[model samples]
Target: MSETIALSFEEIPYDWRVPGTYVEVRPSYTNLGVLGFPARALLIGQQLAAGTATPATPYRITRLDQAKRLFGAGSVAAAMAEAFLAANTTSDLTMIGLADPGDGVAASGSLTLSGTPGASGVLALYIAGRRVPVTVAAGAALNDIAAAIRAAIAADPDLPVTASGTLATVTLTAKHAGAVGNQIDVRLNRLPGEATPPGLAVAITPLSGGAGAPDVGAALAAIAAEWYTDIAVAWTDSANLLALTSELAARYAAMGRLDAHAYAGLAGSFGQLAAAGAALNSPHLTLIGARASPSPPWAWAAALCGVATFHLANDPARQLRSLALPGIAAPAQADRFTPTEQDLLLRDGISTFDVARDGAVRLSRVITTYQTSPLAVEDTAWLDVMVPKTLSRIRYDWSGYVSLTYARHKLADDGSPAAEHAEAVVTPRQMHGAWAARCKLYERQGWIEDAERTVAESVFQRSASDRNRLEARQKVRVIGNLMVLAAMLQFEA
Candidate 1:
């Protein structure tokens, strides 16, 4: 005696309640990723604007790597130079030499030291981290400036040389060597005993009173504002990208099983949006849809007999009730049926439907005819309809009707296809075989728990911790799988 017997309705007594499907407790999970792109962008942008980081250049990453490596060896000069060149190609700054007391001497009286270097700007003289005072003398050589510095040093031993240009007068650490109203005059000169030095006068003048502090506060404030603005813009752009990713994820969640034509539209739209998003540096997105497989065993069995029900297409009545409540809800369908030029068809005894777009086929109607007994399970169906027409006639189906009208279908060779025409379509027959095989295997292998575990684990992995950067992604995938399972249920019965 087998655990269960397989019999048709005819073999079993009508009074006895046969094995039928009923709804079971079901649960689902979703996942998504939500990266804060704007925040990252703002951080990087602020760093660049604040001068904490240099402007990025072509190969900037490579140069930064090289600079890091060279820093440990005390040979970063070359690497720094390379990074500088890589960052900037026009303006440049160079280091000359250290400023220390030596090389020259200074006197109190209006002694002048002059050895002009270049016409870049006013000559700068830093001595012991302080400025030395000097005035330029017209038409003086660098050597003459050096000679004057020597003489000043000889006159006053208290004055000591701090720094000197390669071709200009030597600078002293202090402008005043205990002399009241002391002044310095620098004439362009060269090094002592040199044949000839540059004639440019590099002069330094030390005033009597204390120097005034430069007011750079206003300038610094402006710079700070600029840095903040740059960061904000970067952040805004990044935020938009994150927002778009979220929107895409939501869109995919709403997707469902498509008729052949609807599938075509969806596939096309997805491809276009995905490409555009990639170009905008947008994160990749996923969409969920019904697959060719049914839901879990119990769920599938319940759905096959129309017992288990998932969320339905938005119903106007439900929407009205929700609006009366406190929180927002999904969109609802219109109260009245909106008709278009296209015809709708509902397959007999199946939940699947189709929308036909062709000539002279404007509407469809479902006409169910009762038989003496219900059809047997696992049996193929056959039907033939003859219609007298002046021209070729076409047949199409939709959610609630089957359309028969005068329309010609393009054929490559002979009139009708060889019974196995592989036209694009979404019918129960096309989806059931695959579902049944998988369901039987699943039952035999007892893999229902595995499937549930996989889904649950995936959801956890996406929402792992508080940073579910991929929450949207998970949602789309979940929705797509649900759609597939829903479609499978219609035929898996």
Candidate 2:
């Protein structure tokens, strides 16, 4: 016996492991990996300087000045501001704006003033929300006044126009390239002459340009590469909305990455919104229409998008009701929908807002475009009944959490062939457990319901024929918000 000494050796497991390895299971999903973490919004519109912005690139706009610089101080910038203000009302927001090189013509207008000033006076001129006041000497000629006005307008750095004209007429060229320039109004007040103030006349010449066909495609391409929860096309025209819906649906189906919901508004009556929604018939799109009166369609869309983004970024599970729109005014009572009008809107998949007693505008019911489906049989159809913003956030959170969690873990494929197959199957089961746990967390937080049953019905399987492949299915029960109540009062003696 050669010593017959039994030597003990430390047994080390070949499997990779760290002494304190820990996986953090988030209670909720978040878009932290995106360029702009919480308040990211994509705004598409016609930019004054479309050439300066790169096509199909998500540009982060943190300040109004940055938006002005990228888009030029024009209608596009104004739309961006509307969106930014609406989003920032609840929380700080960052807008990613894409300037659409639209086909519509830029509008040009000229104001011609007749007659000379009889006495020294002050005249105020309003153009595109910018006001300029001119002081005329007692004996100043009409042409001289026009020249002074043009010079003054040109001197102001804030006006989005280049002024040019002769003595009696002033020509204002829009800095932005779109039909939005057509909205510019020029008002003259505090004139020098007593006899009708020599009447100021205006002539508007429309700009002819490219059809915005390329714009939606470009925006969708850019959005496909990034992460965003809310998208608003600043234009409210039917053609733009149609193109946007088509592009968004196609891109989302193809990539199936993040869920990007589009917010839009119709400037027509309740019937119009209903018709549009029925024609579109898409769950991914949310159409808002004012029943109280005709409202600024773009502003409504922007405000809704801002609200949706804020809620999703902060807490993806909350509803967007009773949230006050800071800059939005309440629609007129005449414009508000009657009970019958509300029924039509709900049936047609349109969402409307309500004006609170305090004059604050609040979201009534955010609906989706899945209106015609049989509500009794299709659970998905019922999804349209809840707030669209809330539903979108839930879907995004669950999908993102599942994707990120699976991507982080590596499967073991280096054992005996039987062992490898077993390990592969085990990995998915482990993943399924983690995913189920996440769903449970949402249930605990009132974001979802019936987590256990949903997980059991969900599929998690590795292909028996292919050891490397794994497939999974996840079902979720989204918890709805309390939007309505019914009670019967009993009189006691």
Candidate 3:
């Protein structure tokens, strides 16, 4: 027969008392109440040389304005952090900056001013929707006018491009060296009230011929030991995107259990985005597409992740429909996607957004790029972002509960000999009871549905291969959101 009573003390020894009424106190690790799992977000992008922060080093950012200081003003990393903070201020945020490639080519555009101004008026130069106004006097020299325009663009640190004027020609150079700089819009006027000054003929040459994308390998390697539940990726190139997806998938494995969801935006046409989306099969990545929007794709990426982190931290199963992305401009009315186009995007694994009548951009639906299983068959099991997020939450909480609770507990068979007041010796039946209790907690938290069914079907047994090991067959039905509704309205009886 086994000993009826045992005292397991990690620090205190039962061999020698040597004193009267000697006792020891130990901390309890039982988490009886609801577990709190707030998500942490990381923003990755290129940083300019002006920034003080070291390259590939992640910094925990608490203040919104800290980004502009740490990542340099007008930098991609700073912009992403700003946009994210504008959308959400509560979520834990971290940012890492990557320098532009050494051999990178900076995009350049030229505007030639000719024919002296006949009327004194203001000339508006809009770069990425920010206005740079230059006032020209009547009959001013063309060369002087060009110089004035160049100086105006140079004065603002926020502009994505730098300007230099020679004779009657002014050239604008992108601040960063990459293909992304090619999208820096250089236009005369965007609003109704803005117009080009009369008598000044301006020839526009679009910014082009930028190359050399920064390698995201260093950034990924730097965060290998760290855990980020939500990530915003700046580069949309195929190679960089694939790197992020692979890393996220690896993190989801049982060994690491450090799952993260990635969000990014692509600037392309309906057909282009659809083709790109159909080619990808991953539940860890989410992509949003847009065209004719002044804001760059990186801003969209950060904004979406920020909003998602803030809301999902509270409730992972809630739908993100109609949540407005703050400080993000919606695409023009004529450029917005049609109803049919939006539907097709959802099918192709591309996330879509809607522009309100008041010119606010809001999330329409957020889904993963996973469309099929390994056998190439259609599958909706991991369709939504909620699936992986909820699963990660459950795994974290349950793993902590079980590991700490059974750290030193001895396993035994049913009805085996044990101490009269034993709390450490656990049997298969007791293990099942713990599993059911956890499921009940999940049901009460609205994370899962039909707890009774899950409890009834679950079974626990000692491992056949190893007597010390315990295994279980468990199942859970995650709750679903209300996505669609239809109604029949009778006009007249």
Going through the candidates in the order shown, the clash numbers are 51, 11, 0
The segments of candidate 2 whose C-alpha lies over 4 angstroms from its true place after superposition are: 1-39, 50-57, 89-103, 106-214, 291-295, 373-431, 490-493
Candidate RMSDs in Å, in order, are 33.3, 8.2, 2.8
- State the C-alpha lDDT per candidate: 0.22, 0.60, 0.86
> Per-residue lDDT of 1-493 in model 2, one digit per residue for the tens?
4433322222444454868554443432332332123446676655554435554556666566666666666545455555556556554444444553555555577777765566666676655334577777776777887898898897875565668988787888766556545434444442234222333333334322313323466666655666666776666556766777676566456266555677776655666767776675666678887642322455577778777777656655566777765656555566677878876787777876778777667887777766445443334443442444445555565566656544444453323333343322236666677667777776776767888999899887677788667677778877766767989999998
Worst 10 residues of 1 by lDDT: 384-393
TM-score (all chains, Cα) for each model: 0.14, 0.67, 0.91
Who is ahead in lDDT, 1 or 3? Answer: 3
TM-score attained by model 3: 0.91
Give the per-residue Cα lDDT of candidate 2 at 146.
82
In model 3, pairs of residues that clash are none
All candidates in order of lDDT, best leading = 3, 2, 1
User: Which candidate gets the maximum TM-score versus the true structure?
Assistant: 3
For model 3, how does the per-residue alpha-carbon lDDT over 134-170 read when each residue is reduced to its tens digit?
A: 9989899998999898889878887788888699999
| Candidate 1 structure quality by residue, lDDT tens digits, 1-493 | 6333322232346465767753344221112111111100011111111122222211122333343332211111222223233323232122111111133232322224444543322223322112232333545455655665544444532222223333343434333222111222222221123222234533345423312211222222223222110011111122333453343223223241110000000011223323322233211111111111111111111111111011111110011111110110111122112233111111111112122222111112211111113333321111100010000010011111111110221112222232135232222232232223332333232322233333333321223454312232111011111111234445554
Candidate 1 vs candidate 2, lDDT winner: 2
Model 3, position 263, has a per-residue lDDT of 96
State how far residue 280 of model 3 sits from its true place (Å).
1.3
